[model samples]
Target: MGSSSRRNTMSDVTIIGLGPMGSTLARTLLKNGTNVTVWNRTREKAEQLIREGAEFNPEAAAAVSASPIVIVCVANYEASHNILGSHEVAKNLEGRLVVELSTGTPQDARNSETRVREQGADYLDGAILATPAQIGMPDTPIFLSGSEAAFRRSEPVLKILAGNLIYMGEAVGAASAWDLATLATTFGAMFGFFHGSRILESEGYRVDSFGSMMADISPVLGQMIKYEGEIIQTGAYENPQSSVKTCRGTADLWLKQALEAGINNEFPTFAMGLFNKAKAAGYENEELAAVMKVLR
Candidate 1:
């Protein structure tokens, strides 16, 4: 039988808060043939999942208690606390696995782990790196961190949700820290790309034509990221293939071009500022990875 057809023997999962991501999680689970119980403050939000064979519980405690693993994806840690930490809910969570997937500060993740552990429940804190639309795909990265015991128990279900399930060790905040770092890069790339596109548009160039050139960046970004991992982790910024000086020259050209095009140079200028700072710190001759040291 296919995996979904044999879901009856698999561990049941409960999803709390039928927000966009939460609802997506519930639907993914149901579609893949997993027994699911879902709860949301607004009953209408979970109506679809309910109709799709997911058990809909009006009471949060009932939803949580129905499954071995209860996943909470809400506004943030505060909202999760208010819902899960309630007397009725808290009392029922003992010995269960609580997976917190809400985005929050590392401190929030740590605090939630402590509070949930105090309630006699095993906790795993997670940060989903993909959009809700990408939730069930294998290639989506999900960073999870917490006690090893808790992780071992949840691994099977996690694998079902993500192709890339990164367990960030036993520290509760590691997943959140990595999640924030990933978001920083993602947001930076977003702004940086748009800034350049705008600069081109200002020069009477078609944005559609610029897209073909933009597609060429994938390999460059991939290589840089791979090199950064090898270089930064070992603190080896020496004997450069591409020196900081060369990169700064490129960034300066970008900043100057943006300025000459009468477009906002803020994005390129900000990047140039970093390159300038790195050069000023005497890393001009070092590999471009040395810029990371200045950032530190």
Candidate 2:
């Protein structure tokens, strides 16, 4: 095998794509004293990093061949495939590790893992839960999944790019699945907040005060998350105390007001649907946790 031209060193890393996130990763690696080689479809995008002591490669295959750990942060799975799927590049990737930080579905991540494994390379699917600015910070959360060996081998490099690095087991698809689900939930809540704030603004209510109230009440969502597990596991919605019917009625009234205030009720409407379904399922006297039945 002619000694497999790719070099493996604790300080060697290569990054494909030079978008904000990709560029940030490159800079972080470089700042941490890692030798970084970067490539982008548009060559000029790598200019900034070049000035930061990063080696710029004009060819994608050469970039992949430059290091043991190759990180890709492209636009999508297809773009990721385009760079790593080439015959020459794939052959050169043998015994190397590919860490994909691209935004994609679980299926996409799994499929990429399969392809990379076929090339005798290691694959790790990663999801960055923070923005570009958060890269290299201590609190940036990066979810990783794939082979345990691959994850452990690349931990040092990955840590340079994230504040908090989490391993989500060995299934490459797990990270992507969890990432997408979390993204949907976060955006849903933000959209609901925006709708409420706009309605209050229209009625001459101070948006700042509403924002403060939301900040204070946001902890309740965390409580709901903690209680959700108990509700699901025991199938017990006994709010011991509170009645589901009362909660349902209150939610319905809230939804109606949302609609009447010229605010979009889609968010609250969706919640109401679940609440109503649970109530109809003979859980009216149960606690609000009974709504899990509808959610399930």
Candidate 3:
């Protein structure tokens, strides 16, 4: 801790990396009356925030020392390591809380925690589930996992950026794990939508209308996913409302349609391959979720 006068002048938090997301975080915190200290590799990037009443620290080590909580929103773990991995800067981490918002693997999170803790600092691995524009909103989500005590200490400040805080317990890697899993689910649907759009285009139908329809019936789609997850979790693949054979029929139809329309069939081909594996395993008559068995 610094002297009384120095502490009085210090910001509540120091934000590293002045990228769009980092700038948004600083702006949001300033908007909410939280004193903010900002730093970036490019000094020009900190100019706008300085005009908005943010204090600019030219050095990464000094910037981190200016606040009790430091939030690093850089490009990735590699960039983060390049900045804070230095012995000089890492030394300044003592008696502070470090929140890493950079995206990386679960192992990255674990390694980050080890490094920060080795410097006598508390660390929280965080994953922002919302976009820059979504920051500071009450419903905007952020997932965090780390030392429970550290999380408790940082919760109020973290909630200032994202009110919907999902604390995934003390496992530092949990936040990144959840982020990657959610990304997989989201991108998988996006790829499916790409193929679906092709299907609509092939039929001379409006793809935007199909998207609107998906939005309208998203709850029903969500329910189907939930049911399948339950089936997979419970290892229950019997008495299916929709069997593997029936689901495979839809994949066949997609492939047939794609062939007839002279369109790409990559998505359907992938699905057919999985379903075919299940069929080979004698699960054609089982629930659609039995595909997991083949996958496992």
Candidate 4:
């Protein structure tokens, strides 16, 4: 049988929110032939999904009891806790699996797991790494952690929403940790890209062309990062292909160009501060990865 047919034979799901992400999730599951029960604080938000074959449950507690698997996607842990942490909802959670797709810190995941387990339900923390528009695509990723048994129970239904299901072992906090760490790296590069765009604009270059160039060279950039990561992993900061001093010089050049072009220098200034700390600590001759030591 196809996955959709198998899902029909499997357990139903309860979706406990109706925001963009939650609505997309419910729609995906409904498209896959799974019986979906939906509830949101704002009941009107569930209207479209209900018209699309989702059964609407007005009360949060009743929604939790409507399915064997409950997926909670809310703004944050605080909102999720307010919805599911109540005695009425907590009591209905027994013998069911609660899959939390809300964004939160590691501590929040830990606390949510504890609360769910206290109510005799299995809990799995998850982080969806794609936007609402990406849901149900074969390449869409969802990171999950906590309660291997719970994961096994919910895997089929979860796969309807995302194809790439990355189980991060039994640590309830791993999903959130991985998500936040990846976001940090992504945003750090994005800020630098923004600064680069400003530089190109000052030089009268097309920003779209610069973006396309960056996309083309991304593999090369990835390789460079991999090399530095290995060096950092082994603490082999000497015999550098690129030294801290060399990078510092680049930052200095950026600052100089920013001054001449009369543009914002925040990116270069921030970079220079870190390089100066490494230089002051006598890592000037070491590999660029040695800056991690300064960070540590």
Candidate 5:
């Protein structure tokens, strides 16, 4: 590690892969006084960092061996395996801490965890939730899951990389599972807003006002999330603040509105169907989150 805020040519960390995300990770560390050793198949992708005092390793194994703490953010699980699954790379990875901050499936993380552990490496799998520009920002987060030992060893450096560091659990796939679930939530909300905006635009209504309305939704959403968390953990969705049947009433109104507007009602229809499923199972009095049971 460099100074609390001083990075130089002698990097304390090695970063494998210089794709947009990887390169940004390296530069963010460099800017925050953490020297980085970088490697990429395309030598030129690391030119800027090389000038910023990052050691350019032409070989993947060499990059893996450069520092005790190595971070990988590559194209995919296959590419990750191709780069580090070789015997040549494995030889240098003994007792090393490898944090994979790449977009991959839960199974991908589990597979990589097994392979790296077999080679005597400490593995931590992660999913970055922010874009390249948000790498070192205060609110940017990345979900992490792996051995507790691996996570503890990487925490200091990781905190320098991201403002919010969420440690999911020892299950290597936990982080990816949460990442996908979060994405579903994100896209679901976005899709609803997109459809609403389009529907309004189609009828010469202003969509700009919806932005402020959505901001107001943020807190309501936080409360919903908190309520659901308790409900799920208890496994007793009984006596909800707002019962499934009650929400279904609003869901019905939404479906009718979408129909009247000639807008696609699929989203509302799908939600109503879920509510109906819970009601059919005689859970109409439980919290809306009770529908998760049917989901399983």
Candidate 6:
């Protein structure tokens, strides 16, 4: 039988929340032939998914009771708790596995794990590193951290929702930590790209062309990712091979240009802070990664 056929043959999977991400996940489950029971605060949001073969339940407790695997992708930890903490839902969740894909701080994830466990449910914290469209496609990275046994038990179903799923150890907080770190890197790189694009546009250059050219630099980013590990492991930011001072000068020039362009200088300004700190610390002659110390 196909994966969808196998899923349909099984019992059921329940989902809470029907936002873009939640709806996408539900759709993927439905396509895989998994019987899905869904609940959302606003009932109207789930109507489309219901038409797509999902069973929409107005009662959160009924949804939880209908499935062995309960996936919650609400707004945050508090909202997730608000939905699941209902006495009826909590009471019916015993013996079920609850996988949370909501965005939250590491501490929040840890706390949620504890709270969910208190209600006699196994908790697994998950972080979806892709947009709605990428779910279930190859290369969609998802992080999971919690009970090893619980993860192993749900891996088969979870694989249907992630292209690249990683088990991030047993700490419920690990997935959230990875999520936060990854988001920071992604946002930082995007801000840099946006700043660069704006600067080029101000100079009458085609932003689209600049973006296409930048796309060719993906390999360079891969190298930078490797260097990040070296920086973390060796605590050696200063690359004696390529003086940090040289990098500082380039950063200063970029900052100056940003200021002159009347652009929000937050990105380069923050970068300059690290470069300036490293320069003041006498690591000017070190490699660019050496500036990471100042950043930390």
lDDT of each: 0.86, 0.84, 0.92, 0.92, 0.86, 0.85
Task: Give the range where candidate 4 is weakest over 10 consecutive residues by summed lDDT.
Answer: 1-10
Q: For model 6, what is the alpha-carbon lDDT of residue 114?
A: 87
Candidate 1 lDDT: 0.86
Error (Å) of candidate 3 at residue 95 is: 0.6
Clashes of 1: 1
Off by over 4 Å in 5: 1-10
Compute each candidate's TM-score over C-alphas. Answer: 0.88, 0.88, 0.95, 0.94, 0.87, 0.92
lDDT string for model 4 (1-296, tens) is: 22133233433999998999999999999888888888998878987887788877678898888789999999999999999889899899899899999999999999999999999999999999999999999989999999899999999999889999999999999999999988988899999999999999999999999999999999999899899999999999999999999999999999999999999999999999999999999999999999999899
Candidate 4 off by > 4 Å: 1-11
Clashes per candidate, residues 3 or more apart or on different chains: 1, 1, 0, 0, 0, 8
Candidate 1 residue spans exceeding 4 A from truth: 1-11
Give model 1's TM-score versus the native structure. Answer: 0.88
| lDDT tens digits, residue span 155-183, model 1 | 98877778799999998999999999989
lDDT of 1 at 3: 24
Query: Which model, 1 or 4, shows the larger TM-score?
Result: 4
Candidate 3, residues 151-250: lDDT per residue as tens digits? Answer: 9998988999999999999999999999998999899999999999999998899999999999999999899999999999998899998999999999
**Which structure among the candidates has the greatest TM-score?**
3
